[model samples]
Target: MIVQDQANDFPVGPEDTSASQATQDQLHKSYRMPDEQARDPALHIAKDWVQKKKLPDMSNITDPQLRRYATLYPKLRLTSDGTLFLEEGTGDDQRLRLCVPAALIAEVIRCLHQHPLAGHLGRYRTYLQAKRRFYWPNMHKHISCAVEGCTTCRQSKERKATKQVPLGQTSTKEHTRFAKFYCDLVGPWPNARGPGTKKYLLTLQDAVTKYPEAWAITDATAENIIRVLTNEFFPRYGVGMTIVSDQGRQFISTLFQHAVKRLGVFTVKTQAYEPKTNPVERLHRTLENVIRCSMENEKVHPTQWH
Candidate 1:
């Protein structure tokens, strides 16, 4: 059945409030409020509607396309002449539309001069860019970074980003005066550029001094590190009272621990898998900055950290 503004087609003239089958059906299904998935209350409503077969009211629905749903489900109900909304459930909260519809969100945005949560949205974007495997907005990948909901693309569409871990570790670099140290190994850098059978950089940092020391290696075997400490590092600095490094093979080797014990030096490694535990991580950042600064300032790549 088709409805029109003219009473001739709808059969209900200005005098009568009564409506034709087509007019009532169209009005009933025309309510096209967006389903908000991020809001728990909103998502709960959508979930209940979809799973339990509780459909929205279809009376006086103004949207022509959505009115089609009324034809599909006769059980759906509607009221308000298309203004307010009410539904029935055992509980007051369940029966009510706890969430504002997507249409309402746009309306709110339009009415308000500024949004209260707008400042926090940039941080959310950064988080989305960094991590790509997160199940943020439950919708299918509809937006870049986060397409879960239009919160970007609400309902039926979502783009997930990765999850970020909260390791929450930092170095004592800021507190001590050359007291804390961080050490790590970098590279089995490919030997294609220059024909070295093996190469690595054993990096060390002074927490307070912010000074970094690099020891290049052609071989990174555990024995090599023990030998380096005995030969190069130990002789100049003496054994540090508390040294921090990662759980790499060289650091964890029984030989390294024994050597430290024999030297009467205490050793502390970073929390397992937490890179920030070592102050030297900052030094690595500095080194990268230096490389970048040199490239920009000098217009030539500085030699790689040898």
Candidate 2:
């Protein structure tokens, strides 16, 4: 099939009419190949001239041709660029302006018509309708996808606002305000290397200041705990307003109570089975964590618990 070049390629050589048969009357004006031009990338990428022509009147155009055009230019799918019509913007919407240029629209039409997926245009058309339908609604509303032939963001990217929870438990009001303090014994952790060789930890924490006093023991009897608590720690830190402790037999025993009553130091005990009555228990949890983490690098320190 012979291809017809653009009608306005050059002033169609004024129809030559005077040549005789013997003079070999040229059938058409001689068309010369254009002189080669250098390839300028920028020239190819330049935007097309502004739209000026009236939109085409394809009133008699068959659905088959429209379908074919849609294949070449998806948005304006045309079988060939030459077959394109100048499009007009409707009001200020210029919705079609968001689409590719008439040239590309023409190519989209061309591809669509000839594409093996031509039968699937109805689905695509539904999507195109959606893009136009949802994007910029109610004047300022918006919805669109950034992919080829996508109506709803190409099946859309599912994004969820990340609900990040703060990392650790937050503190509430301070449990006490002055020099009141807390103390407790944490362990007689069974010896890993041998039994009957007991190891235990003692924690003494200030209730008001929240500072800690720590000690380690070979055993956790009431006598041993009170002896060291009164003689050693109190002298240095001064008698606290109060001491809160777990319900160990030592803190409840007569000997331990007598020592506190004589010294005028008040004693508070955590309710049986409730460790939190002693806020120092929280610090104990931290110390336990420290021990656990250090265990990976070194064996649990038995005597250095303080």
Candidate 3:
């Protein structure tokens, strides 16, 4: 009965078997191993010890390479086909990572990084992909060097210029509110028929509390700026000790300087082109965005922004 069953299982009368044979051949070609891990000199000692299930004592091992394998024996596992793997992680998260030899580390990294799926990613990302299936000493360092030396990446990627100057301290010893003020002018927007036909905005920001105030004016002249500070700002918040502003013509004018001096407030002009030194520049961006949104919501023309 057993012989009869085996004979029936086999193809006794072959009929149109060419397609089936081709499919079987294709499957065998696709499933074969890419390279021979047994031929790697670095993993030969570990493979032998793992196969025998007997690790020699590290104290008596004279060879440096053999001693290294002895140290890692607990984590090493040998496959039936002689390939070595490093057992990593714990419990449900555990993985068997192929132990790559030193000589093949660069080739493996190149394959992973330059592969169409990899898209030539950065060092850390490529290292993460490699970590999923390969194990080697100083793997991160090797991958980093490989990425840095890649001619394609060097030629294609844009290098960002780092800021040379460090940030300057902006905090004051006195925590008093309204102790310092950052002042700047925004626009000459489209002329609108508001109070004084307002087209420009004079903005002031408190250094301590960061409280901001703005006034619309017809022009950005020194006289107009001084008039606003004297009539409006000083009456409400009182005079600040220090006034920080950029080197605008109005801020640095002799008339503007005299006006602040009368109030016993020191005026500081920022460097020629460095607006970052003044905190009010940041306030301008936020204020402009708010104005833009409000205009859009109200269906107001640019000329009627005031």
Question: Which candidate ranks first by TM-score, i.e. highest?
Answer: 3
Candidate 1 C-alpha lDDT tens digits along 124-174:
442332122111221122223232223321321222575998988764436
**With candidate 3 superimposed using the best TM-score fit, by how many Å does residue 100's alpha carbon deviate from the native?**
60
The order of the candidates by lDDT, greatest first, is: 3, 1, 2
Scanning candidate 3 in windows of ten residues, the lowest lDDT window is: 1-10
Off by over 4 Å in 3: 1-174, 190-196
Each model's C-alpha lDDT? Answer: 0.46, 0.45, 0.70
* Top lDDT prediction, candidate number: 3
Error of 3 at 209 (Å): 0.9
Give lDDT: candidate 1, residue 9: 16
Which stretches in model 2 have alpha-carbon errors above 4 Å? 1-178, 192-198, 299-306
State model 1's lDDT. 0.46
Of 2 and 3, the candidate ranking higher by lDDT: 3
lDDT of 3 at 279: 82
Q: Candidate 2 lDDT, tens digit per residue, 166-258?
A: 899866556755457778887765342344453777888765577777776667888778778777877886664677887888889999899
